[model samples]
Target: IAEQFVNTDLGGQLGDWLDFMKVMTLSSDRKAAQPDLENQRLAVQVMTIHQSKGLQFPIVILPFLQSGSFPSSLKKHPIINRLPSSWMNWEQDTETTFRDIHNREERRVFYVGVTRAERELYLFGPTSRQSMFTKELESENPQPMEIKTMNEHQDNSLSLSERKQRLLADLNREIAAKQIDNARNILDELEKADRGETADGSTPKSTSREMLHLSATKIETYDTCPLKYRLKHIDNVSERKTRATLEFGSIMHAVLEEFHGLKIAEQTEENLKYLLNKNWREDAFEYRLRGEEFRKQGEEILSDYFRFIQENPPNVLKRESPFSYVMDEINVKISGKIDRIDQDGDTLAIVDYKTSKKKEKAETNLQMALYTEAILRDAVPGVKGNPGKANLHFLRHGDDPLSSHQFSEQNLQDSRIKISKVADGIRSGSFEPDKNEFNCRYCDYKD
Candidate 1:
């Protein structure tokens, strides 16, 4: 029985190989081995809403749907709500407006989940639960299982402190409204009090103009969400530092930069290893427990980096030029520490080293595009050069071949326009926190 079952092709060649086990097997054992067998053959799939994209399934059971379940109610409101409408059209069409953007995306995902069922579909829900999808599903299908489970009793009751908080909130709103009324009454009384006073009065006390200092990030923040910016900057709420991949990338970058700064002949394997040991931060282990694994990975990365540098030693002619500048600035005082700036007489090249795994199509990032703009405008004076002429190098992990992108002025400008739009949104206080499951999983601000 084991031999026959093992030899039976489950789906394809891979499936056949997976099923072919040397030991004895049972129905329970096989079920345990392939836990997805129920949904696998039933033409029904039980998947998280995100995984349902770009594929068709006859039936999809979205068991959990609640305020904090599917479309998490924890999403922070957009900064646009605080803006005094001279800046943005808050009353625009629901589909086009920024206010409804997140809701629309959520609805689209819900729609995709619903449409995935080719034939008969079932949407299960609890009592008192309502959503756009819930309404649509009920209207379309008409019949849905209404399951009501007994609510568990809790030992704890509302505390005195909790009651006090509710009372205080009510009192505060009443007090605020009363205060406004009182202020108006005071203004009317002040006119009667000052009936005999001169129009000029005694010269009003001089007041200082509040200084406004703005950075590129500040401007961007302002456009994204004014309220958020106010909360972050004016209120001085410190954003907590969380898990950042930048730290890992920085360590690798520092090592490579050091490697390049050394004399060409001195960049040997032994010397590189010595530099890696000297520069490595022992304290970084506190964030991630995979310190030993990272060390091994770092060693592997160093080996690859060393080989690439040896093969493509900095071109001397390209390096020596007035067009090339390190840590150049773009708009908003935005500057980047360019790894290698190369100039071939009329043409310019910006090379950035990445320690990430290689992708099929190497693309230019916003940071790189900004760097190219800075180089053209700030680094090279009076040179109305073509943006497409510039070179971009992406050095990946392992000794794989470098991926290159030719920077174009048009592309750079287009990138700037998009960045500026984002900046504008932030400046106008329209920035909203996009709720994503992946983000929630890794986010330090999840609470």
Candidate 2:
């Protein structure tokens, strides 16, 4: 392309084109990512399965086909809850047993990964710890090209925790040997032994009597998946993958808090942007480029929020307000952070900023009712007369419209009853794993 421009004999035109291209490239601030695709380039190539979807290769090697490496744990899929489960048509090898949608997708991707190699294909993983396709591979009786460790036949008596650790260690060593391609990820996992906790950074004590404080989230986790709650709160297990969205939401909340905390004189666009930069997090995003994009997206969301405020600014009385109350009915403490409290005429409105694209089911929103009850009884500073309304500000939407949930005596009472029941259920110490699978992977427990 440069040669074509040079051959045009337009003297300064080629130089102008080069300068323009340079500016365009630099404006994005994204570093060089793609490798030279030319076959004669004589450089080792690497690409993710999704990236190589329609592309073919002369020789392809797929690493880490062990369980949880490809299909991932079914207990928590980012896209699973986007739509209702009934709409999905289950795929299966034999029609009798319904297949997991995520497992089916993984199988299809594995096929694609293998078929890409027209000449030769290689797969690397621990032979004893194969993923979903392990049973089929064993039935076929295929031989492995290499064995990294001596524990070819794992002992049956080994504890589940022990087995998990061994497998994790093996995967890491294997990854390190494979040109240390994923060493950073491995290191991050290894460094997680001391991390993963509740928002307050408290780990669950083995003694039930020690746990005097139980938040709404804690109760919700137990109700949704008991084993998950045990692993996360009780045992404290380490998470395998980074929760980008969770971190993204946290950063957004911090920025919003800062935006509200500022005085009117200090609430300029530049100052707001500075607060965003101060609260900006790069660790949550998958890559630096994505982090940059997220920061920019955050700024845009904030701008939209600011515009909304200009049009219809409610009297914000509190920012990132904390409220803790003991549910005397259940004898458990339910606490949560109310994003904002605003005075709407005669009553106070509890507002929460929902960063997610999906609106949380209004009926299932126990926090709103819980906060309202606290405000009405406790006489929270913002509530002038009666504690009534709650607002969910969805920042992602184009118009930044508010979703309001009005408080009714019956519904509030019902919410209290539900909370009490859930609290009692948890206090009973019965934790059943979700039918799909154990949600240990996504849990904050890292024992």
Question: Best-fitting candidate, measured by lDDT?
Answer: 2
Best by TM-score: 2
Q: lDDT, candidate 1, residue 212? A: 32
Residues 1-447, candidate 2: write the lDDT tens digits: 343333332332335667756865787775756655667325556788888888877788888777667656556556744555444565743333224666787788887787788787777765333555543445555555654432325433222343234435544455646846466654455445333322244433332433347766776777778767766665544344445667788988998788788887776778878888898755455444556777877888888887888778768788887777776544677677788888888888888888888776454577777778778677354444577578878888749457778888888888777776666556656556665435444444322
Alpha-carbon runs more than 4 Å astray in model 1: 1-244, 287-289, 316-331, 343-346, 357-364, 380-396, 399-401, 436-442
TM-score per prediction, in order, is 0.43, 0.51
In angstroms, give how far residue 252 of model 1 lies from its true place. 1.6
TM-score of 2: 0.51
At residue 74, give the lDDT of candidate 2. 59
Predict model 2's lDDT versus the native: 0.65
For model 1 the local lDDT of residue 238 reads 40
Question: What does the lDDT read for residue 189 in candidate 1?
Answer: 39
- Counted clashes in each candidate structure: 17, 7
Name the 10 consecutive residues with the lowest summed lDDT in model 2.
Answer: 150-159
> Model 1, range 1-447, lDDT digits (tens) per residue?
433442342222333344554333433454334344645646444577778787776656766664445554546567745664345575763435443666677888888887777675566644333444565453344654544432244212221123233333333444556776655544543454233222243311223222233433454455444544654554344444422344456777777667666776887988889887887764353222344566777788778767776776654222312343332122233444556665445665666666556543334456556657766676544334443333334444454545556666677677666665554444444535555676456543345
